[model samples]
Target: MSELPVLIYDGDCGFCTRSVRWAERLPVRMRILAWQEADLAAYRTTPERARHEVLWVAPSGRVFGGAAAVAELLRSARLPWPVVGWAMSAPVLRWVAERVYRWVADNRSRLPGATPACQLPPEQRPGHRHGS
Candidate 1:
């Protein structure tokens, strides 16, 4: 709607929250909101989709998800970020980057700044072991 980019993320995920906060230091002028606090229908996203991945909505109404969203955010940032963004958008690199992003997201609870709440439920977590 507006001429500003919107970054939508999961409010309940401590790791996601921390990552968004860290993104504030970037030079991009954007609005950051938790999907829980926003009307996702306006962005063409469902609650389930928002809960599963970060989204980037451009001023031109383009929507990007997952690693692509990360690339768009970086592309809007200043200096070195744009370079990194370009690399991530490269054909071969984009494929690898997406996988890496998924891996990190799946293991986010074990990362720095993550809280227990950031951990996905056992059934949803990657490589989850059934019982002990």
Candidate 2:
């Protein structure tokens, strides 16, 4: 219901929390709320959706998820960030960015600042259940 963009991120993951804190320094005016504290219904998102990916809700009522949401946020930021955002929005680069984002999300617990809970369950991890 806010007139500004809203960045919805996972609160329980230490890596996510750290990343959000870093993102707060971006030169953009937006509200950043943890998914646990957000009104998901207002953003046309469900708890499951929020749990799985970051979301960006625009003032114009557009909702972007995953890497696109990140790109949107960067686009709203100033100067160099917007340049990076434009690169992410490009066709081939966007495809690569999406894949990279998903890989990072799947391996977050192995990343710096991550806690054990940041790791996806074995069954839920990419290629684990499918035996890839």
Candidate 2 lDDT at 62 equals 83
**Which ranges of candidate 2 are over 4 A from the true structure?**
120-132
Model 2 pairs whose backbones collide: none
75-106, model 2: which lDDT tens digit per residue? 99999999898999999999999999999887
lDDT of 1: 0.84
Q: After the best TM-score superposition of candidate 2, give how far the Cα of residue 76 lies from its true spot, in angstroms.
A: 0.4
Which stretches of model 1 miss by more than 4 angstroms?
A: 120-132
The TM-score between candidate 2 and the true structure equals: 0.88
**Which pairs, if any, clash in model 1?**
none
Tens digits of per-residue lDDT for model 1, 41-125: 8887777677668999998888898999999999999999999999999999999999998998878888887876677563454
